[model samples]
Target chain A: MKKLINKPENFVDEMIEGIILAHPDMVRTPGEDKRIMVRADAPRKDRVGIVTGGGSGHLPLFKGYVGAGLCSAVAIGNVFSSPSSDQIFQATKAVDGGAGVLYLYGNYGGDVFNFDLAADLAELEDIETLTVLGRDDVASQPKERSADRRGVAGIIFAYKAAGAAAERGDSLKEVAAAAEDIIENTATMGIGLSPTILPTTGKASFDLPDGEMEIGIGIHGEPGIHRGALETADEVAERLMRPLVEDLGLSSGDRIAVLVNGMGATPLEELYVLYRKVHRIAEELGLTVEKRYVGEYATSLEMAGASLSLLKLDDERLALLNAPASSPFFREG
Target chain B: MKKLINKPENFVDEMIEGIILAHPDMVRTPGEDKRIMVRADAPRKDRVGIVTGGGSGHLPLFKGYVGAGLCSAVAIGNVFSSPSSDQIFQATKAVDGGAGVLYLYGNYGGDVFNFDLAADLAELEDIETLTVLGRDDVASQPKERSADRRGVAGIIFAYKAAGAAAERGDSLKEVAAAAEDIIENTATMGIGLSPTILPTTGKASFDLPDGEMEIGIGIHGEPGIHRGALETADEVAERLMRPLVEDLGLSSGDRIAVLVNGMGATPLEELYVLYRKVHRIAEELGLTVEKRYVGEYATSLEMAGASLSLLKLDDERLALLNAPASSPFFREG
Candidate 1:
């Protein structure tokens, strides 16, 4: 594929430079080796700072959420790769603000290890820190071990709850707990119809048959649990939602918020068809859909497929869901 | 330009069906004359109902914004064609819950005419209505007549502000006023690196040499104001932003929100490159970016280009921007 880029090796550096240039309203503090992205209007001291880090490729995922009422800073790594401990530490210190900082990220092995090391480094600088990992992909595990599932689009919901908590002066620990609560309540499962083309490779990370799809796929081009011929829109929605509903054990009279998110390449029309089926199924199950979203919330480059996420809502989760947030990807009061 | 669609005529209907099937949490009234998308839990009488309508191919433009705290109904027409007046009228009546309804859409001749006609039809049924048209594409018209410019990605910001206003229980007139204010304050310009494939023609809507771009193109394959060899990201950003900055007549010390939106095919990396240049120039011009978004907010199929939008903001626009909105395409609260 033809792309407008210089050297693939310098892609990330150039990307970071461009981010800083375009958002001078945002601050890019170069640390020892890494950079931290922060809102230009850094608030006064005494407010807990929100920090998130992750691999690149998911634009507006880690960095897009940086601003008031959202993440205070973002530490970005290479595509599908975790940022280094030093990078995380630099971002933590840069946005600490003296109150504390909460490091929120997806539950991936590399991320956990690096974030733990970064926490140790931050503590040496007298900066307190807390961490919360999103583990919301129900399809990654059987129903008996759903908590061990990988994190995906459901992390956006966690970001909002955590950002709202941080914006309201919650301590780092409290904010971390709140984010974890949201993550635990949320569950996601994705299907990939087409593979994403890695920027460096310029080749698809993986491939499936032209008229087939892989269910329970990972964002980094990992194989899904099941591969089948292309199904009708209703069948696709059912296949993706079955695990979430079964895992969440959503029963009659339960209230939930549903997100039918396109992986990347699926059109909005197809998403709505999926939504129609999912809504009917939810009603048949006696659940009330308090809120709904259908579109590309989290994507894997130009991959085709969709993910279904459900957050079992209670008063607290609902309140946080209703809290205001502003990010490049998602904006609200 | 290969797409996975089965038949040309079934593309829109099939896609809409897929969305509803996947997002059972959302509602799409099937067998209707027009495709009407609505939140599943709609009919909330307390909040002012927000609605938008437009042509298809621009995924998430008219359809993706249907959800809580955003547009309650989005009437989608055929690819690059306006929804009929009756179709838009039915959507308005379906979502109207007595508080009132605000018809917000892009500034295109067909859309304006149809949506206005829909408003007239709705009023005859005792449903209060108001209209706000987005006219943000500064490059579509000469500086002397910038208000006549076509709308593009900037309409997303208008949807956001109007959604927030409705969510806050602003009366129909109040929401309409807020949306109009956003339209007046916003300016946008786009450059096309590649043309989108029109499903009917099964070919690119327009063509450019491998190393060229067309600036100031509309979402529906409209001819651009200027075309030239492809330039560096910096040059492209300047070309798109200079007109917007000049047309808006922004003075030093102005605060604005920025949107760096892709026309489908451009990668986030390039968008960031453009954003960097746009941000630097804006900073040099003494503008403060209160918010920034970088992604495919309003796309034209798989076109390769980007648009830069600046919404000059005061306290009111800023507050409305910060308000909670929950749409499929954009949501935080």
Candidate 2:
């Protein structure tokens, strides 16, 4: 593998160390283990705590969101692997204020299992905790089976909405309700042009032949709906958006926030190209785009792909999404 | 090459269209030609307009920086190619805010030549213009002849400092001096682990065998000083930093702003690993890091490598660096 790493086994530890060092004022580890990253000024008195966790490769997701007005703490695992329950419990304990703590993360099986165990552990400590799973990938399942779909870039929107609500002194139940609303309204799908290399094995996690594309692949190389010859940017955008728009039941005069997210290796220029097509489609469908973000929000490890996420917005969600946020990887002005 | 693009020839134009569409509130095109992108609030009365431009492919560089307290306008070019004099002239005319305009860009030959021609064109139109070239790549030249070095990631520092100065209502000469000071004090170098594929040609810009690396590679696949077997992140960091520290004459009590920038395909997880080593090295050298940015600030198209930039800071420069700035791709809180 031609990666700039010292040793594959130490990648997670070293990366966490680097993150803490780079953003000393933004993030910190609760214990010496360095697996549980908490906001530098976390545990705000009398406020609902927002905690999230998952694998490591998808940056600016679990860890990057741990900051003021966003996630209060994050449990980081190995690349494409779930964090242990102990780590999640530690993160929950570190960020719990008197109100309670909310656990927000994707719908991966390992992550779901671990986070549930952590919630149980938190209860033993007399801390009330709630769990909200994000499963917005339209291609992963049919509309009737939306709960079976995987979470992709749409989780960022959930984080933004829920974090904002929590920052406004919402109760743990209120924050969980807000997060569930975002998860229900948001939809995302992506096309993978290349596979990401596994750092430990120095090999591709999955195989994608040159000149072909995989539509709706999961963040960790999960099977998508189909594999076909590469298509034009307009065609790719249409294919990715058709399912999402239909899944969300978007209609004329619908207000929404759009995210054109890059999956690691895709360039921002290309992401913009995809965004141009997405915006045009939204306009044609008479959807009012209230806010737009086009860049790498969540990613695989150098995987060449792009995901389109649309959050059908209500007044409350829109206001929360626009709230101020700052982190090492994400900042809003 | 597996990229999410429609047609190779349409890559630059499509990307520009996407940028304008995604950031309608932040940027716009001046005329029918989409090569010149100006801030939506351009031509502010009595403010010295700051303009920068370069080839495409490096997203968030010339185009992404055009916003409040950053750049006033940007002239874009084809991938890895400098903009023509006519395009630069048009941008210069569009952003001249009655005081004057400052042309800031890297020291590449084609850019220097075209920008000089644009300045001449602006002179005929009675728009006073000043030029400040950024040459901060320590690996590209010897310290005795630093002016001959190529511009790289350090150019972003020059933009941040000078843009803040211009936004603060500094005179044209004052902005030029501030930009020149940043260029003189900053130093950068990069290491490439893999080659970038050009969209138009659909081929790798250069070649590298598996398990090998190149130190001090240029953004456009230019040759570096050394090529050998791949090294660990610590070793790579040391090699990349040795020349920059020596060239800058950094000593025990210097305060600097550090940027650990990814060259497209490198993961943020790996960037933090590199940053961990870089922070340790800076501490060992007794340099105080006043500000740190770790992300893909400047990039080649999906090139798997990274660069380190250090800008020696004083009270004046430090204030400018910390000043509030907002753009599509960059935001400071």
Compared with the true structure, all predictions reach lDDT values of 0.77, 0.90
lDDT tens readout by residue for model 2, B1-333? 778888889989988988888788888898888989988988888899988999988877878889888888999789999999999999988898898999999989999999999999999999999999889887788888998989988998888888899898999999999999999999999999889889988889999887889998999888999999999999999998888888788998998899999999898889999999999999999999899999999999889999999888899989999888888888875
Could you tell me how far off, in angstroms, the CA of residue A267 lies in candidate 2 after the best superposition? 1.0
Error of 2 at A245 (Å): 0.6
The TM-score leader among the candidates is 2
lDDT of 1 by residue, A64-119 (tens): 77876778888878877898898888788778788888888888889889999999
Provide the fnat value for model 2, as a fraction from 0 to 1: 0.80
Question: Residue B17, candidate 2: how far off, in angstroms?
Answer: 0.9
Model 2, position A242, has a per-residue lDDT of 86
Against the true structure, whose DockQ is highest?
2
Where in model 2 is the C-alpha error above 4 Å? none
Which whole-number lDDT from 0 to 100 does residue A221 have in model 1? Answer: 69
Predicted structure 1: clash tally: 38
Clashes of each: 38, 0
lDDT (Cα, tens digit) per residue for candidate 2, span A157-209 = 88988888898888889999999999999999988999999989989999999
